[model samples]
Target: MTQLETAMAILMKVFDQYAAADGKTSSLSKAEVKTLLEKELPQLIKQAKNKEDVDKLIKSLDFNGDAEVDFEEFVVLVAALTCSCHGRQGKK
Candidate 1:
């Protein structure tokens, strides 16, 4: 696979790995999201001022009003974070 294909596959795999934690196998529960952030993106979690802020961040990512994050919504969050990080790197 090309780099982009590999990246997309990795994204799906990661989402599935976390999303499966709650037996949902499709969407990520809030707890699963928190665990993902804390384990996979510790810096992002650490930057938050407190647990409430982290909760709010996760809540904000739930765009479908379902109280859980589907793969599409998770991709949006990942893409946004990727863009944010890329932009920061460009500024340096």
Candidate 2:
């Protein structure tokens, strides 16, 4: 798969995890993201009450401003908060 596809998949995975656990992942689309925010993340999602906001988010993390979040950017945004340690590789 191309880098774009990988990025989309990762985004979908993160979206699904949070949506399912904390919100709703049934849609997984822009609308769904808004819904997830309204239903789950009331605080931050409040800032993104519509698809346009979601698109803005996608653009913000898109880095190159390609209007699309590629794998590299997606990895940076989604993976930054994850992983207990950055340099450590072995299991905890």
Candidate 3:
């Protein structure tokens, strides 16, 4: 697979792995999202000013107000972070 394809696959796999924690394969619950961030995005969690910031992130990511993050919502978080990092790199 191409690099982008591989990255996409990895993203799906990671989301599935975390989302399955509560026997729910379709979306991630709040706890699952928190655990995923703590384990997979440690640096991002570390950079958060406080727990409330992370809570705000989780709330913002739930665009549909469903209280759970499905694949599309998860992708938005990843894409936003990727773009933010890419922008920083370009500035450097």
Candidate 4:
């Protein structure tokens, strides 16, 4: 697979791995999201000034007002973070 395809596959796999924690494969619960971030995105979590920042991030990712985050919402978070990081790279 191409690099982009591999990345996409990895994203799906990671989401599925975390989302399955509560026997729900379609979405991620708040706790699952937190664990995913803590374990998968440790750098981002470390950059968070406090727990509230992480809480706010998880809340914001829930676009449908549902307590859980679906795959679309998860992709948006990843895309936004990618854009932010890419923009920073351009500046450097």
The residue-by-residue lDDT of candidate 2 on 1-92, one tens digit each, is 99989967867776666446435434233444446446554655566578677667645665675443344554564454344346544456
Clash pairs (backbone) in predicted model 3:
none
State TM-scores per candidate. Answer: 0.91, 0.34, 0.93, 0.93
- Please identify model 3 stretches exceeding 4 Å from their true place: 88-92
Candidate 2 Cα misplacement greater than 4 A, ranges:
1-47, 80-92
Tens-digit per-residue lDDT, 6-60, candidate 1: 9999999999999999899889999999999999999998899988999998999
lDDT of 2 at 7: 69
Candidate numbers, best lDDT first, in rank order: 4, 3, 1, 2
- Candidate 3 at 51: error in angstroms? 0.5
Candidate 1, position 70, lDDT: 94
C-alpha lDDT of all candidate models, in order = 0.92, 0.54, 0.96, 0.97
**How would you encode candidate 4's per-residue C-alpha lDDT over 6-57 as one tens digit per residue?**
9999999999999999999999999999999999999999999999999999
Winner on lDDT (1 vs 3): 3
Residue 39's C-alpha lDDT in candidate 4? 97
- Between prediction 3 and prediction 4, which has the larger lDDT? 4
